[model samples]
Target chain A: MTDVEPLAVTPALEAHALSLVREGSRVLDDVSFTVAPGEIYALLGGNGAGKSTTLLTFLGFLSPSGGSVQVNGREVGADVAAARGAIAYLPEAATLYGHLDAYENLAYFLDLAGRRVDRAALEAALDQVALPPEARGRRMQTYSKGMRQKTAIALALLRDTPILLLDEPTSGLDPVAIDEFHAMVKALAAAGRTVLMVTHDVYGACQVADRVGLLRGGRLVGSFEAGPQGRIDTETVHAAFAARGAS
Target chain B: MSLVFRIAREEWRLWSRSRVVVIAALTIAVLVGVTSLLTARGVADQAANRTARQAEAEAAFFAQPDRHPHRMVHYGHYAFRTPPPLAVFDPGVDAVTGQSIFLEGHRQNTAMFADARSGADLGGFAALTPASLYQLLVPLLLIVLGHGIVLRERESGTLAVHLAQGQSGLTLMLGKALALAGVGGLLLLPVAALALAAIAGGEAPLAAVLLVGGYALYLAVWALFVLAVSLWLDRRSVALGMLVFAWLVTSLVVPRIAIDAASAAVEAPGKIESDLAMLSRQRAIGDGHNAADPAFEALRKQVLDQYGKQDVAQLPINWRGVVADYSEKKLTALMNEIAEDRMTREAAQSRVVTAFGIVSPALALGAASRALAGTDLATHHRFLRESEVLRYDFVQALNNLHARALTYADDAARSSDPEAEARTRVSAKAWSLLASFRFVPDPASARAARAVQPLGLLVFWLAVLCCAVVVGARRLRP
Candidate 1:
């Protein structure tokens, strides 16, 4: 073990051997990772790979069967609101109140995240995510999947949390929206925020992530560092994921 | 607009395509229909029994052996307010408010034998009528059908696709609410038709239309509320559990608890207390022509003074007539006061219950529907008041005959001699002069004043639910 004290320095997000058990089965087995400031880590997995479970557990929505999750070097589960306050989570296809307009949707989440954004700031956040001006006042019931996804991004931006956890963030976006989302993720990391994303798209993950980790059967099977100058092909990642799947 | 209709149609198609949903809808329709029919039948049977009993009581009163007017007052008549034709749709408080009242001279009787609260263990499980079906069961069905509208989309991974296509959660929730409202309208069709049938038959007024409108809006409120819950909870199972608990609390628990609290808050004087009070007051007032009392002596002296004669026999006006008039006025005052007090207590209880309508729309609708049906506490009070007035007139008419038709010497001698008493008894023709009791309900114009507060509360609930939908939509992330 490294002699470095886990608590001495504050990382954006750090999970030291976090484990979660459900119904006598270990869904997340001894997962350990450190997402330092300005780092983007993509969690790559197939079905039942414990990607969603790990994010949820880190949000303090689920208690770990064993191990600890920390955000800004502060322990999670012990202080749920404080831990949640530091992180913003975007579930796959985030469900919004359909009766409210986009602006109201953002406002509600901002309030929930213990931050208040004035209308101008709220509008700026929406604009940053590439949501149209006209869509702000229209009820979210009229919004498309891409527009809703943009609103979700706007919500997270309004929170201004140090860490972001996203599950299948680009799953249903159109090409343009997906590109805009990738650029937004890059910008967030550039701002010294840590991002932990779960994705199945190898190319998309390679484009946005600083390092990629493959998970199989509740365990992180492989970790690859994508250096700034180094190029990694999708075929190599697919082979590694398949080999782990076979094991 | 056509897109909305198309979406609504799609929802209908989707709902019908699910065998479970279709079966549930069918079951609700059948239950509402059967409940309507049974309640209507029950109302009709009750009306028939009341009418037959009323006619029998009248015949028996007229068929009696000739007796003194005071003795006839003690032999009271029974009058029952026949249930209205629309009461079949919503019995309202008919079961809680007694239907039959014993009307007699100098005494006010409580309306009795009409409480539905007693012995209602298992009877409450089976639907009593369409009112029960709409008030308790239909909203529950709507919740079951609509609670998964958004949650299922999210659960099955289709919600993201829908959102990606430019649809928002607000639009989805609204679409589902509109669709459920349509289903609610469908469920209401049979009952609306029944209410219309009553109006066309001349048994119900145009106010029945207002009843249908109120019920429709009330059910819509429930539909919107259910959709709101679905939007709020992340998991479909959690949404389902929460919605069911809400339905149970609103429909079953809250109203029962309110009823108990209201009853405890306002205690109504029992029938025995009222009877004894009337008896004591009557004795204190003095029985007219009974020479053993100070009140009779004062009455005799007043008659003589009014006629400017030294004795009752010497007065131009029949002294017996004067005595009968004086006695009845006193008794009438006492009975009226007692009746008024009882009515005041009952009204207080009803007001307390009505105040709870703000929390539960079911109570508001139930109260309003019953008021429109003319079967609530107010209507019961009206019937009793009218009966008392008629009883006074009937008794007084007989008293007038006893004074004018019979001589004073014969009237006084009847108490001592059986031969003179037989001679003193008024003829059957005199009995026919007394008017039959008739209950005339106030016109439609009058009912609005009584129903407006509850109707306003129902509207308030609808507005609150509309706000909830907006707030809920705003809370959705993406």
Candidate 2:
């Protein structure tokens, strides 16, 4: 008998014709996308473009009014705990417990996600996010925005979840920190993690994402992908984003 | 459950670092401790003072000189009401209801030495006992400290992260409530110690236990109420405003209005009114004091017939003493009927107040606390009734001596002639034959039984608030 090739692997995340209505207003309309294992997909748009709303839908925070969202080939609404268990979310301007130091915040959140990581693993994750070693033991209230973001990102990294959903992940980061974050995201993808990030920064999304979907007025208006150079064209996506703004 | 506990620990850690929370907790602990000590001292002092006065009155009664029995009837004894041991915690209604009543031959006297002269308006929380702090200020402290437990999470976006970490809404709600309840339990510690001390001091053990339990449940109810309000509201400021308004209405406004409404709804006749009614009834029975009244004339004829003598002088018993004894029995019977009617009206008024407890947990908790401590209106009425019974018994015994100890001729002439008056006097040792007045307090079991209805009302409040929490939990979201 001829050897049979393995069937195509199921996508780690899928949003098919996802439509959401919130407070009597349509926030998402007919959005469809797929994030395979080891892929980073970014939904790029301006404010009110439903980018964050899409990420929330996949995390089971918001139920779509029409169609559906799935995590690892299973409907999100069918098993919310399992859906959440598989994903680590970093929200826009992520704020951790101000009363707790960076290390404590990391441990607390990691414990909450049902992970029993040791201090060494936590430090390693913090080191990966390039958080200042001196600031790890001080209360986060005294921490700068970039420091807090780094702590939150380190927490997401320590969760070791198969899927990561991030919204405006680098909103307050310095340029160097933003570049480092991009490299970290790339490394996590190489380790076979599926990431679905939503942002308004076109150049940043192009720098890190394997595929970029441009959104406007709650709809996916255009799409782009990396060329043979192994990076998406920033200028082309920027032109599309600006054109949509003008229209 | 472990997850809930973990979340609770985190919440404790967060609040423990908050200076405002720590200060508020310390303030409540100090207040409870001080209030408990001072009130315990006050209750002990009052109880000792009443017991001493009662003994002094008894000694004076026994030290009387030989005299006519009727004169002894007018010189009545005083019965003092010693407060129950549990009153240290509650002292409820005691300041308003007075502690001593005078017992005499032909009248029912109201209790005396009340702090407030009139009306049943709860005395405006004038008594600052440990129970009052538990009922009033602790709940306010709880609201001040915990109204932001859930709303703060939402406002800071930590709620979204928590949910994303796979924490269920129910778990979060319950966990935060457990943390708040722990704070409430901390406030109750000093009060519990005092209650335990009362029990150890040979007080009503059941009542002391119930008092502690009632206050604990009350605090728990407040915790649930604070949590439900926090979960239902979307903003911290709004939750705080709503919760404070709720506390003011339930703890302060509603209870006072309920008491005033009860007093107004069921109007108990005043002492003057009851006394006048009794006087009119006495008149209908003919003046027992007037030996020649038609009512006693029949009694005189009956005595002659019983002795088979045409004249009272031939009878073995002194005729004038017979008249005094006969009239007194009739008067005592008439007074008792009138007194019973007045007591019934007062009891009805109390029932109205108890029914109003369903509307306010503060009223419910107060009723439970008072009933358990034996300082309620029911307990005071029991004291009055018992004293009246003793009054009737002792007065009748003196009248019996008047019939048997004196000669008819001497009793008749004693008022006009000095020699006959001297002869009519009985031995001073006769006073020793009479029993001393001792107020038998309601049994611990009975006092505990009276608290059941109010305790049930408190439970009902808890149940209703629990339902609200469940609904709020279901609707909780990031």
Candidate 3:
């Protein structure tokens, strides 16, 4: 038999090397990135490295000073709402209303997004994120950082969009929870969804990400791909990030 | 729109799940309910008390020992202001205006027994009526409940997530507004129901509906303002602080300042000036005693000419009737002119104060509610005018009775001779013929006139807020 044709992965999102300016200051300088279908792209950066700004630009939270961002092949600024519907964002710290339980928070978000999932479907989505069924009924005020993060993941899951943008998703979780979160991200990518994560957790990123990029002073300085036989070590990626800083 | 309702429902569920929101809502409902009940009972009791006193005063007037008609005119009658049924809801400025005036023959009396101010030395807190609660306290609670609608989401970074989930800023703002407006509707329900019940029971005017509508629109404006501020501000704390300041300025500070300015701009003639002017004018016109007084002498010549027998007797018509009619006409003219001037000044003041309703809708609503209740300055002026007319009627009726029942010679001699005084007294049955004072309010006509201005102002603000919501929605997007 003829060799099977390799599946061509299409980009779920693309940004045409954009710059975002705010109040006469360029926060994002010629940043370019893309997430292909079924790929995990880890955007690594330190404080003020413009990683958050770049994600916001892609999410249509800010207008680019120049160039453009696209989701599902549509320009972000031109049709922001339509573009945004194709992606889900879990911001840093992901504060849910303390007065609402996990299920209630999820329902509010779903309803706001014009989605009407039944209770069973909502519960199944929470179960997908490994959130305890019992904890879903408790107020978010009683939740730990890991539990809140899981609820955020549940919210992102319920949207069922093709792309996900998570900002420092593992920043405040314990080591075990961080590992579990990386597993969840890997599972999402394995299911043919594009996932972009902004983080300084190089080891965690190396564990889950197929490709890693270093962001420094509003520009990406290095890019690397993990080999299928063995994962790239965290120290090598960290050294590259540090070198970009030194430069 | 359906998505907005779904979000609103979810918000309501979340709000109900919060103990603080529930407690705050309960507190407002209870306060308004209790205040309304107390006001209704107070108004009913006051009306009963005034009715009893009016009966007693009428009885005492007719119970007097045998006396000349002129003596009865000087004795005068007391008219008590009847409170309107819906005054229980707002009682707007009712306590500031007097409730009773002593109407007499030759002069008009200023109303008495009104307390100019209510509440404590701080002066900001007025009486805790339904109107005050709706105007000041309910809006404060609304601001507290609504000021964090968007800001909280933004602060927690959920706003970006929400935006990413296909929620437009307009939809989000509408949802929050609906949620808070639901609470507002709840707060208004009991009072509105009470007002409706009062109307059904025929104790209140139909204009109570206009009052309720005014209040609803006012509260809605507050809710919209709070939500707009929430969408514009970046932090919950900033939104909350700004809304509280706006409430204070619009509801509390601006009304007091406007009233004071209006009062200063149109100075009302004081009671002493009016009383002195009436007394001096009466004395100058002779009290029909001084033959040298030109007005009285001219009146006497007319009476004599009409009689044609001139020595004050031998004519069929009583000279006493002619003199009484002339004196009554002169006094009525003077009082009417002064009353008209005072009313014009008060109207000017009211116009000035109402013009500021644009700055504070609370004032507009308050003024409109008071007018609908028949407890406003217009009502007070009505009472004074009606009382003056009734006084004129009563005194002139007694004068005509004197001309017919008693001889002119007996009337002229009765003051000096005790026996003639006994003969000069008319039968007490005549007093029963006198008309009792009744305040007939055309509520529909009055409400139609008063509602237009306040409703216009409310609509203007609504338009402004619609524009604000549009701007806020644009700003709220990620």
Which candidate number has the best lDDT? 2
Off by over 4 Å in 2: A1-6, B112-124, B310-314
What TM-score does structure 1 among the candidates reach? 0.67
State the lDDT of candidate 3 residue by residue for A87-202, as single tens digits: 88888888777878888889888777667799999888888777888899999989988889889888988888889999999877888877888888888888988998888877
Q: How do the candidates rank by lDDT, highest first?
A: 2, 3, 1
Write one digit per residue (lDDT tens) for candidate 1, span B1-478: 4434544555676687677898988999889888787877787788888889989998998888767766676787886776666777866656655577887765666643213431121112244778778888898789878888778766755454333322344665676777988999998898788888778756646568777887897898888888777777799899889988888887777777766877788876667777887787788888765544677887777667777889777766556766776788787888788878877877787777777888878878777777776666777778878888877887787777767777777777877988888877766655665576667555655665677888899899888888888887644542
Full-model lDDT for every candidate: 0.75, 0.83, 0.77
Over B1-478, each residue of candidate 2 has an lDDT whose tens digit, in order, gives 8778888888899889999988988888888889888998888888888878888888889899999887888898887877777778877777777788877777778852212322333422777778888888899889988899888888988888888898788888888988988887778788778778878876777778788888888888889889988888889999999999998988788866776676677666667777788788787666545666776777788888898999888889987667777777778888777767666766676666666668777777887888888778788778888888888888888888988998888887887999999998999888765676666558888988888887898899899989998887766667
Question: What is model 2's DockQ versus the real complex?
Answer: 0.74
Tell me the tens digit of each residue's lDDT in model 2 across A68-124. Answer: 899999999999999999999998889889999988888887777888888899899
| Model 3: fraction of the reference interface contacts it also forms | 0.90
Candidates 1 and 2 compared by lDDT, better number: 2
Q: Is the docking of candidate 2 incorrect, acceptable, medium or high quality?
A: medium
**DockQ of candidate 1 against the true complex:** 0.04
Best model number under TM-score: 2
All DockQ scores? 0.04, 0.74, 0.70
Query: In terms of TM-score, which candidate is stronger, 1 or 2?
Result: 2
Ranking by DockQ: 2, 3, 1
- Model 1 misplaced stretches (Cα beyond 4 Å): A1-247, B59-71, B74-76, B96-98, B112-127, B288-291, B313-321, B415-419
Best of the two (2, 3) by TM-score = 2
